[model samples]
Target: MLRGLTTVSHFSDDVPAAVAWYAELLGIEPYFQREVQGKLAYVEFRLGDYQHELGILDRRFAPPGAGTPGGTMTYWAVDDVEATYQRLLDLGGTAQQSPTEHGPGFVTASVIDPFGNQLGVMFNQHYLDVFTGRPA
Candidate 1:
């Protein structure tokens, strides 16, 4: 059976630049990196309460049909969707979706990073409840 997410990977034509961009956005440098054929091939950062892995891979190793920047979007939990969306924009991410409310307790936003990956942020009551051990 499928389990929780362990790593989220994004591809970039320039791995070093992507790593630098993400480092600035996250306010931390990658904890690990790998090189292939004397060229930087990948870098990874551990983040979030559970230390989820965010990886940037050199596009040269991507699969044949994986040239496109995005497909399915994965939303990360945030305390404030609007603030996070604004921060992403300030970090040079292009706006894809402005903060929008869904139902009573869910707000979501998305952006396209300079590397062309879709990064989503959400303020969800359920996530906050679980994270804070509070009843919803």
Candidate 2:
């Protein structure tokens, strides 16, 4: 049995810049930020829709090899894929894949954050309707 994702943590060389970038893109200010072991380090933001807390951690304090971005990327469902992609680009995010239709009514795009983590934005009205048993 699975519950739900609680948090997604990312490592960054510059914590302040990473936090600011994410805050601007996600439109959510950090709910918590604190120093750990006498060093100003971790920052976490609670995103809209209660998805999960996004964390920006100082890579110097991260465990061995933990600073590297994993093979798997994280995706956030958005109502407007194009608008969000543009916003990300404007906020210094690098576009890895331009918005594309994945299937009937499903669109997706990928962008790399300042710290090299891949973030994806997806829109799928058809899939949503099917999942919720409603007309699209």
Candidate 3:
């Protein structure tokens, strides 16, 4: 019933700023966007070797009863967890968790973006193995 990771999304109150911030972080502009009367409402970016989708939707578009921006987090793969974590902070994200190794080579970190969404990052051997077709 499950295929694979398809998309990871976040909410933003300011579309242009969020788009600019992620464009800098990912080094690519969003490939898809929806606008209402010339105002961006939603945007998507394809990233990584897997071409995983990252969506940023306006917070107003969220379902009813969704109060704040904390929920299931999807950790993105990065070459350097520590450096990426710091870079997120340097780009105005606040720290949620410092990078830490979790035995047997798994390392993860978390940060709250300027838009109040939680963004996670990791340096994973399994991801590299799967991406490169190498044994983990």
Candidate 4:
């Protein structure tokens, strides 16, 4: 049974550029990196209140025909979905979906990163409640 998210891996043709882009967006460098045969192959950043892992893996390791954008959409919790979405657009990400209110305490947005990965942001009251150790 799936318990919780451990790592979210994104494929990138240019690992270094992906790492730099993510570092800038996260405002911190990756805490860990790995090289395969002297070539950078992966980088991992620990972010958010839970310190979840965000991983950038060399596209060469991706599954067959997985280069195109379209797959699992992982939404990271944010304080301001609109502001975060705008920041992503300013950072060279293409908007996939503008900020939209799903219901009373939930707003969501998505963007396609420069490396062809979809990144989602959300402001969810339930997530905040659980994060704060309050009843969801």
TM-score against truth, every candidate: 0.91, 0.81, 0.91, 0.94
Clashes of 2: 0
- CA displacement after TM-score superposition, residue 127 of candidate 2 (Å): 7.6
Which residue pairs show backbone clashes in model 2? none
After superposition, the stretches of candidate 4 with alpha carbons farther than 4 Å from their true spots are 134-136
- Per-model lDDT: 0.89, 0.80, 0.88, 0.93
Whole-structure CA lDDT of model 3: 0.88
What is the C-alpha lDDT profile of model 2 across 1-136, one tens digit per residue? 7797777788888888898888887777899898877765999988745447888888887778774555776677788899999998888888899999978778999888878777888897864665578444
Model 4 is weakest, by summed lDDT over 10 consecutive residues, at 63-72
What would you estimate as the lDDT of candidate 2? 0.80
- Output candidate 3 Cα RMSD: 2.4
| Tens-digit lDDT string for candidate 3 (22-136) | 9998899999999987889999999998799999888888776442556677899999999999999999999999999997768999998898888999999998878788444
What lDDT score goes with residue 121 in model 1?
Answer: 94
Which candidate gets the maximum lDDT versus the true structure? 4
Which lDDT tens digits does candidate 4 get at residues 32-115?
999999989999999998899999999999878765677678999999999999999999999999999999999999999999
TM-score, candidate number 3: 0.91
lDDT of 4: 0.93
Which 10-residue window of candidate 2 scores lowest in summed lDDT?
127-136
Residue by residue across 1-136, what tens digits does model 1's lDDT show?
Answer: 9899988888899999999999988899999999999999999999987789999999888777563546688899888899889999998999999999998999999999998888999988997777779444
Assess candidate 1 and give its lDDT: 0.89
